[model samples]
Target: MSEPGLPPFESIIAGLTARPLARCVVVAPHSVEAIAAVAQVVAEGAVLDLTGDRARIKNLLAEAEVDVSAVRIHDSGDSDTAVDRAVDLIRTGDAEFVVKGSIPTADLLGGLLRQRLPGRSACASHIYVMQLEQFGGRTVLLTDAGVNIEPDLATKAAIVENALQLYSVLSSARPRLAVLSAIEKVSTRIPATLDAAELRLMAERGKLGAVDVDGPMPLDAALFPESAVNKNLAGEVAGQADILLAPDLNSGNLLAKALVGHHAPAMGVVLGAGVPVALPSRGDTVATRRHSFYLASHLTRSAATSPNGCDRE
Candidate 1:
């Protein structure tokens, strides 16, 4: 029998409606996309605490006739200070999570990393949660695609740990991790394969948290049951991985786009910071923004279920 993990993305979105959340979002509203994304968040019933260009945001919302009853505006002046203002909200207990509005991802994340937030990890990694039909509607994760560029072995381990923490919150079963590589053989010719080998050993030694790790595997083996069977691979995570740990950013980014190219059924968030962070792309649709915020808010709803005790009210 398959292990119990997160429900399908459809069910997750439905659950948000079934169990409404009470959360506050601190956003840097500068671009048109930011306002559009924040509209979806407010539609989800979250209180929006706008942190940039207070007057401009108010005027835009008024012109668009967006319901501002639940919106709160704060004057931060510019994107740089807006990030600071958002951090201040997190520090003062005014907001629970940070949403990437119009702020550049590098600036926002860099600013956040400088803060000494509670429960912060050495490395902050991004996890993309997707429901793959090839995996029987199972919710799977692809990690560090949007954050780390060229993570070393130690950084890859931190990324895996972050993914594991998030997995624990969303599932009842122990996470089955597949460390992705070019091939299944551990050869020094390929550095990713070596990292995969180390990660597997670390998991066996209880160094990578409560999860089953298998790696040095190709993508075909990671997501295809037939490939696992044909190759005679009998490990626990051969074709039933809950999280697919990418070797580096280039491969991770390409893999995610390939898997989710035709549709938009993925939810993304950053872990390892003091709180869950949603950094949805500016080009993403409003629905994507809604689901991303919902994903972050869902993590915040229960402290017992949050990764590394990372969620804060």
Candidate 2:
């Protein structure tokens, strides 16, 4: 039976089974939740962890039926050294992904992005959270609330790219993106509205990939067909939006929370790196955490099986 008010984690896991797990280097392996997750994945493929509690880890491995040799458990006698070693693995290509364990987020991210990590061209990375909701009969992309602060136009563009890439990978379709604002019209007084107009043009000129872009939409017009029609917005994407590009973190975060607060199912992943990264929060329930792992795992596997982020168009 499915869990009450939450989507079955298996639904996401079943989708992920098509792809192999992304190799990860977990910092502070002493974390119970991290160890359990790693143990489950290690049965199929190995992951590296910086943990000195070898005996506990060993027991978890045995119970999970994972090969003892499949995982490389590193002992970081001190907290300072653990971060150093974890970062080293990413720099040396020993691990493709990093999972934050007992360590704080700031510490984990700081180490992962240490001056030496490759593919770092100031690409302006952000997290795109996709919730599988039956919202007016479609799935939509919501983002940046889980990452980024007050992003400017350039950073917003990059966030769009990240979301588009994931949509292309998962939905196998060119997402119709609505760059959201408080109102449908561009206004110089509102910075977000002005940026929305710019993004729309970027999409039209084919600079933002193969996607239909419309913008400066109010929240109602972006999500509901009647609202778009009532406002006389003339565009296929107006009502059938596949992605909603939030102006910034505050709006995006609030929207995501509202969805979950009303019992919507969500799965989020961090993108634009060499590999898929899972950044589930501690406050997130186990179901949310597992779903995120499914997203990262599936995306990694899909990328491996087919290049170009899974969109042939």
Candidate 3:
């Protein structure tokens, strides 16, 4: 869902580009796209820490003609070692944020979660930011696509909290959240609906802060005004949802992939961890990965200045 006067998603991406690039560690950058993406970031003046095969990294950077003056390498022969080293960099404040590269996402995230970081334990979840043409180029946020498989109510609550933290970083306005399900009515038979209703109640009780929460909503009713009108569903978030909390990882991942498959302007990040993590899929283009880095860096900057910061852990 959209607001009339808010800046477009493209503007946000452009703003991120205009800002000085933050220190980032690219973990296991062993793929073509990862190299290309990091190369572009380095060329654009980002100080980067790379953990991977030294020879392969140098060859690729030379091909891209990226200035190695600003790049630091921690040669690791194994992907797991690379991932662990990246986490250590963040844990030691050597890097502001992390960027996923060639390694399996599970390996990178497992390292981040299981390792003893600076902060206390927190539930980590992935959040996707996308500009969908179908929504009139509106930017939407979707959560748990990269983490949280089949979250229970407590985990869902944690995801919502993480999304709200991200929304605050992205906008000054209060975010409208929609807990999406297959239908728009509360029904005991559908577990998602039950969860949605409870979430809405939690919002009403100020448990989720000063945000507007609506749910047990179908996709159409959540974002499209016409659908909400036809369905007689009216709420602050019914047709203007800024954040979407999916029922589970299966649905969340599929919906997020659908948007990416359409080549929508996009970025993904993992929050609620001790540190912010940029998420780049195996097949993501250089542009996508670059934007993800910018987004994660932006989050890092925002958190650094704020007293609460973004780390839920």
**Residue-pair clashes, model 2:** 0
> Which candidate has the top score in TM-score?
3
Per-residue accuracy of model 2 over 210-253 as CA lDDT, tens digit each? 88889889867877778889878877677667778887777887
User: Which of the two, 1 or 2, has more TM-score?
Assistant: 1
Assess the local accuracy of residue 21 in candidate 2 as a C-alpha lDDT between 0 and 100.
Answer: 56
**Model 1 residue pairs with clashes:** none
* Per-residue lDDT over 16-64 for candidate 1, one digit per residue giving the tens place of the 0 to 100 score: 5565544555567766766777776667566778788888888877766
TM-score of 2: 0.78
Global lDDT scores for all candidate models: 0.76, 0.63, 0.80
Q: Which lDDT value does model 2 have at 192? A: 89
Candidate 2 stretches greater than 4 Å from native? 1-13, 29-31, 42-70, 77-81, 132-134, 300-313
Better of 2 and 3 by TM-score: 3
Clashing pairs in 3: none
Q: What is the C-alpha RMSD, rounded to one decimal, of candidate 3?
A: 3.4
lDDT of 3 by residue, 1-313 (tens): 3453235788888877878867789988876788899888877878899998999888888877788998899999898889878877886788888888887777777777667455422477899988777776778789878888888787788788778777887788878888999999899999999999999999999997878999989887888888889888887788778888999988999988887775777889987666688988776778988899998888775441111222221
TM-score of 1: 0.90
Residue 271 in candidate 1, Cα distance off native in Å: 0.9
